[model samples]
Target: MIEFEFVKPSTVADAVKALAADGAQALSGGQTLTPTMKQRLATPSVLVSLNGIAEMKGVTVGGGVVTIGGATTHATVAKEASAYPALARLAGGIGDPAVRNRGTIGGSIANNDPAACYPAGALASGAVIVTNKRSITADDFFKGMFATVLDEGEIITSVSFPVPLKAAYVKFDQPASRFALTGVFVAQYAGGVRVAVTGASNNGVFRWKEAEAALSANFSASAIAGLKVSPKDMISDLHGTAEYRAHLVKVLTGRAVSAA
Candidate 1:
């Protein structure tokens, strides 16, 4: 590991200020960040620890919407299942207990790992990412693999998800690590339907407009039958072939809709 200075900022303003310093990186749960540091893949000159900031650490539900602090852990979300069962399920499905206890929502989204489950939830639920600066829509937040619209020194404060009428997440794990080889999130709201897929695409997360259209017409498992996803766009690796993942996308979408 590279030698670096660590700064634990007690407030959001301080954290942001620290992050503004040259070659600075934000640390939340450190589930992904620390490992990268140890591997020498990431070597920030300064580490701005957000753990000291009390403002970024809770879950709130009001006016039919759910607001989650960026630093909120997956374990907390899972333990508070009664608040949003589907979201809790999504949280519980990430990594293992130790990881869930340490991995955070902001960390997950900020990293934007292709196989991470939270991005699917955010995209499907039309969640808003609230940062120290401006709010970004889920669609506009994710750029690509391990990338987001977050600028230098920007710190995500919280995420706000509008409560849906019904929602569910289904995923096929990669076995050893339990990372999603292919995952799907389906949400049915009064306005319409939203379907988001993760783990299969190189682009990280993407919407299934065809499936969404079909579900909006008739919110049923059979509704997704006519939707076809091209294998050409999916990622092919040791877990499964691109063709196989394409098939899983359709299969998982069916299962998610049926369960919903």
Candidate 2:
């Protein structure tokens, strides 16, 4: 990696101010960014570390919503988010021990990797991402692969997920990286049902509306009987073909629903 000044601020405001400097980039777990930096794909002049900020670290669940601090590590979430077992289980399975200890939920969501698990859980759970500036819904925060709608110098403070009546996440993982080859999240609320799919589309995580409609009518694995996922918008990659990913989406959604 190139020479870069590292700043660890103790407060969110101070960190935000530090990040205001030109060519300054935020650093959390370093699981994703560090690798890219080593490859020389990213060359920030300064690195602002958020791990030192005490206010942005913890997890809380009450009043029907599970709130997790932006800097809270995956291991903490796995232990704390018991109110939403689906989300907690998802967190626990994110990566190996070291990654779980170091990776932060905010970092994962901010990066918005197409194969990442958080996006699908957030989208299906109808999470609200709180930032230094404002609160953004998961639907609006994610734009595309490695993209989000966050403004410059805006840091994620926490994420609040509405506890669902029933929800589950099932993923077909890519062996080497453990990133989802295809993942499905199914959530049933009193109002209706939400189904989100990830790691299968080039456009990134998207709602499986047809599956949602099917499950809304009848919430069961058999509800999705004869349901089809077209390969038109799915991703074609070295790990699997578009058709293969499409099939996994259907199968995984059914499994999630059954488990839920």
Candidate 3:
């Protein structure tokens, strides 16, 4: 790894200030970024660690919502987020034990890896992405694969998820990486049902509106039996074809709804 100055800020304000410097990069959990740095794909002059910020490292549930600190790890969520069982289940299944213990939710959301589980959970749960500057709805926060509206030096403070009446997430793993080849998260709330698909779309995690509309009318697997997901916008790669992923979108949606 390239030599770089490292700073561990105890507060978000200090972290933001440190990140404002040119060539500074935020380091959370070090699950993804560290590997990139070692590979010379990322060579920031300064590395600002978010792990020391106490405010960004816990879980709280109240008033029909679950709030997770930005720096909270997948293991933390899996252990402490009992109120949102589906979300906790999703967290528990993210990866092997080592990854679950080290990967932060904020980093996952910020990276917005198309095959990552958190984006699907956030988008389907109608969660709010809280930042140092302003709060953004999950719908507006994600821009595309490995992209978000977070500006330079901006930090995600926490994420607030409005607990749904019923929800479930199901994914077909990509084996070696355990990343999703195609994943679906289904949430049913009083307002309506929301279905978000990840690991399948070329544009990143996205809502399946047609399935949502059908499931909203009837919260059951059969509700979306006749519906189909177009392969045109799906990702085609060595693990799976666009057509195969698109098919999984529908199949997994059914499994999720049934599981929910």
Alpha carbon lDDT of each predicted model: 0.91, 0.93, 0.95
Tens digits of per-residue lDDT for model 1, 19-69:
988999999999889989999999999999988788999889988888999
lDDT of 3 by residue, 29-123 (tens): 99999999999999999999999999999999999999999999999999999999999999999978999999999999999999999999999
Give the C-alpha lDDT of model 1.
0.91
lDDT of the structure predicted as candidate 3: 0.95
Choose the strongest candidate by lDDT.
3
lDDT of 2 by residue, 172-222 (tens): 989899999999999999888999998999888889999999899999999
Cα error, candidate 1, residue 103 (Å) = 0.7
Better of 2 and 3 by lDDT: 3
lDDT of 3 at 113: 96
TM-score winner among the candidates?
A: 3
Q: List the residue pairs that clash in candidate 2.
A: none
The number of clashing residue pairs in each candidate reads: 0, 0, 0
Worst 10 residues of 3 by lDDT: 225-234
| Models sorted by TM-score, best on top | 3, 2, 1
